[model samples]
Target: MKNNLTSQQMGKIKNLFADRVRFNKVERLVYSHDMGMMPEQVRALIQCTPDAIVQPISTQEVINIIKIAQEEKIPIVPRGAGSAGFGGSVPAKAGIVIDFVRMNKIIDIDKEDMTATVESGVVWQNLEGELSKRGLTLRTYPSSSDSTVGGWVAQGGNGYGGYEYGDFRQNIVSVDVVLPTGELKSFSGSEIDKVYSLCGITGLM
Candidate 1:
């Protein structure tokens, strides 16, 4: 995978992200394995390390990274906290692992409308704390409260309180995504169905 990226491509990413892009073999190794308990046989056969890892601090940065990925024809795996326990964060084709940890800001908490706009990286526990201060609470949460909001959604809706208030899908108001073509778009209500059905092939949510 490293061999697929040209020096110019590497330079472009380095120039844009500075210290946030990592290529060192040791550091990159961490992205290979996920939270799943992989069987020894399967683990022995797969060398899953990604080519590089990029941590974007904002939506604009994510868009920029996607644009670069498009130009370079590289696979971009969107990751948040890497707690999904599934291999969703592990790059299948060995390209860029776009870690969203740095983008974990709670953008807006609209108590009036009973909704919140958060960066994809915002953790459930953090958001819960924020809402609790205002006497509000999350409708549902996964057993792992440290999981990112976006991660839960990508893992096919979320959490344990579905019996009481419905699942993640039922509560979602809208989603802001960065498309593969580097276009930024927002989908709400029924529009989000298309994105969900595509399984994120169209964009990063």
Candidate 2:
């Protein structure tokens, strides 16, 4: 994480993002924690208040936000439902939180390939329901099916249906990512492992 941005830096973000960027104290506090279990001492002493929360509704918006953050050297925490039982989405330093709830559209569902292309913000249960309507279902999903697709993929592969279909990594055919430096790239096959490891640390999910 990086230190809080200067007002000038924040002004640039606000001008570019309009209402999608929030810096109010109430909203900042809301994005500071997750469903993770933390020690009382740690929780009481350190509230991970992000400098700002940015909600991007599309891939283009994500790319734009990443570009700004990179130019400003701001650390970004990409978040989904924040349900991982760990503080994976919590910003270690006060910086920017890219909350993906609005980017939750399922982009594609290919019955022929038995695959779905979803934005990272999509919820697993919603996808499961949609697939079932088409006489299909996910090979695996978190027991907390409400967890977002990006969040599950980023946190490493472990979930329900693992005994049969394996984990998320096996099911994920490829991923489209915005690199930390703000470049867009697609990774598939064995290459995806490297991308997965980078997770929220090095790039957008």
RMSD of each: 2.0, 2.4
Give every collision pair in model 2: none
Error of 1 at 198 (Å): 5.8
Total residue pair clashes for candidate 1: 0
Name the TM-score of candidate 1: 0.92
Evaluate all candidate structures by whole-model CA lDDT and list the values in order.
0.82, 0.84
Q: Which candidate number would show the highest lDDT if scored against the true structure?
A: 2
- Positional deviation of residue 22's Cα in model 2 after best superposition, in angstroms: 1.0
Put down candidate 1 lDDT per residue, 1-205, tens digits, no spaces. 3445778988999998999999888777898867876666765675467888999998889999888888778888888778766677876777888888888899889989999889888999999999999999988888888988877667766468889888787888888888888889998889877566344566887
**Residue by residue across 132-202, what tens digits does model 2's lDDT show?**
99999989998888889988778877778899988788988998888877788888999788667445665
Query: lDDT value for candidate 1?
Result: 0.82
Q: Where does candidate 1 have its weakest 10-residue lDDT segment?
A: 193-202
- How far residue 154's Cα lies from its native spot in candidate 2, in Å, is 0.4
